[model samples]
Target: MSAHQPTQHVASYYAASANPGPERPSVSGRVECDVCVVGAGFTGISAALHLAEQGQSVVVLEAARVGFGASGRNGGQLVNSYSRDMDVIEAKYGEETARALGSMAFEGNRIIRDRIAQYGIACDLKEGNVFAACNAKQLEGLREHQALWQRYGHDQLELLEGEAVKREVGSSRYTGALIDHSGGHIHPLNLVLGQAAAFESLGGVIYEQSPVTQLTHGEPVVLTTPGGEVRAQRVVLAGNAYMQGVEPRLESKSMPCGTQIITTEPLDEATARALLPNDMAVEDCNYLLDYYRLTADNRLLYGGGTSYGGQDLASIEAVIRPKLLKTFPQLADIKVDYAWSGNFLLTLNRLPQFGRLNDNVYFAQGYSGHGVTCSHLAGKLIAETMRGESERFDAFAGLPHLPFPGGRLLRVPFSALGAWYYSTRDKLGI
Candidate 1:
């Protein structure tokens, strides 16, 4: 398997509509920095920007362009919290762990906003995200979700029922919804590209098309690329799903799952408005959920269906188009302008894995399907840990991450079975 992706962004709507960015040269000769970050996706870019703000000389090595991986191609919804929510954290870990996570649950969204405002990043920033419930049972789950988040000091939630829900989301498929005023969406590729620009402005360097082929750990870790080497006091592995052969240790505890997305041809303003009245990003309350939002161009971008173990679907549109039609049958004739798939790292427990390879080599991955917000938070926590403030970072790093029950070879089948079981429950609305 390759250590990273091809040296270019994948062909997706995000890539086609991405902000113009300079093509950085690959690593050449030897360079030294206070920190060397592997992978230029959200985790690496966010960490590099944070470290630069902290007065550290940072260098980011990317296998492809910035945001080329899941960071650039995800659902783009800035949903707060980890894949497993705070309540789950409290239950499985402890109150202390949950409190620490809760304290920073919403910080990622704020950090993103700050980055946009501070750097003048134009990523079509929007506000509000709705957790639409498909059934009464899921509606009750939304109520529980609202209360759970409120207990964590997130008071931006409002439960919408009946007509109230339609006012926010035009989808009649929803029985009710929970609106998180603070949650929202963006052009994910543009957002990461903008952050990369900001990092460069702060004197941080990023080398595109540079994959770390060899890592030698020491006081000054050495990361060897195809053309050159980077030596730094510490290294951060932030490639998430794309960081495959780069670090096998991190790979052992997580599996990469692929999700498909498709964007319809641009709709007229009226049509788009009717689809999503308030233009808020929406995701159904299912174990295998369907998420959709109206793009700035008025196209409906819908995504769902997972191919466990990073297997690409034969036809992304075939899998996702049906899901979209199921939600909005009125779009039966709408043309799909773009379709693609991206991988998200999933842990057995559905939480992110944050820990150190050693004292100086840290890693944050396995965000499950909640990388947009959690990846940014991971960057902040990583910078904090590197700056000798490990209290907040340790909260996540302390959690145990178990490998798949069947190991790498059989992990796919096992995960597929688990997904089938949960998806069945979702169908039964249990």
Candidate 2:
């Protein structure tokens, strides 16, 4: 951890390469709206846009700048699904629920692409996402996964074994792989900023540098911010993990865990293509998986290793550099251009929690590190729910969630122990 903490976006490549946008003013006076969505990341921005386009008086209150949180600092891989694969849902919640979840899994990708095209947002969107299998067990899992997702009408999946995997990745590490042609990647920070721009174009209001200090639930929900207050017919707590002390009830339902990433100095186009010839983003199947992809600027963005209990290391470079070298040993001498970490809310159930704290106060969080797509989906669900159409929202709320066994204080220790077991299983190729 740095001696002085970072109150803005972590020192990340995304922050370094963020789009040029005017800084928004903080909330300063009383405001009223049809909907007040806190946190201007993916879920909040998407919800604001959806609600605003529907002619709802939407006001987005962001503690930080647009995409300043995970929306800005993620792996930028659009994996086109939830963190909980359908098979897991099928086994745990039956096919009806699995079908409900699967139907909306890829819709976020559609919304993202649609917004990009409609607004002409320059987010460097790319196509294709490769799922690499690190061992025989993982390869078998991919085989089963291909057939499983196919049963759910996902025909865009193509499984590659042995030489095919090597040919696609330019790496012999993965035994086989599954490439989702329907899935894609993008400059995530730019994507959210674009979404914010789209939200603004729709006449939605956004207040930045305005952290919510208190929430008083009533006929019109009241949000107390440092500079102002907002009373709305509906309120959305979209802050996710960064929402510390904002709402204890929301905080109790999910634990904040962290993931870190490192970006290499930009490579020559030839070298970038050589490393990932197909230009597809890749994520492995390990419990603590490594995700990587080539940037629009020809940089290799590599990241992995999860801190289940959430950790802030003195040097993120020290924690992630070795992880990068392990994946591409030939790049051991490559200059590390940027290193940063961000938190995501982790639920005990691993499924996202979407429900209301009470009537008119809805919340959607705990994507379990799958925020890229699901968060956007949550935004859609929230908008639909706010409009009194809760069918889709109810489907996700149908997934069961339990509070951490020992509550907030002990959740990290409990989770750390569980992570130890699973990550060991990952190392053992189980």
Model 2 segments beyond 4 Å from truth? Answer: 1-5
**lDDT of all predictions, in order shown?**
0.90, 0.87
- What's the lDDT for residue 214 in model 2? 89
Per-residue CA lDDT of model 2 for 1-430, tens digit only, reads: 1214355777888889888886999988899999999999999998999999899999999887888788899999888778888889989999889888888878988888888999999998999999999889999999898888888888999999998886668777888999999988999999999889888988999998888888999989999987889999999989887787778887777888889999999999877877788899999998888899998899999888787656776888898888777777878789989998888889988889999989989999999989998898899889888878999999998787889998768888888888889889978898
Point to the candidate with the largest TM-score.
1
How many clashes in each candidate? 0, 2
**Candidate 1 TM-score to native:** 0.98
**Judged by lDDT against the true structure, how good is candidate 2?**
0.87
Distance from true location, Cα of 107 in model 1, Å: 1.0
Residues forming the 10-long window of minimal summed lDDT in candidate 2: 1-10
Quick one: RMSD of model 2?
1.9
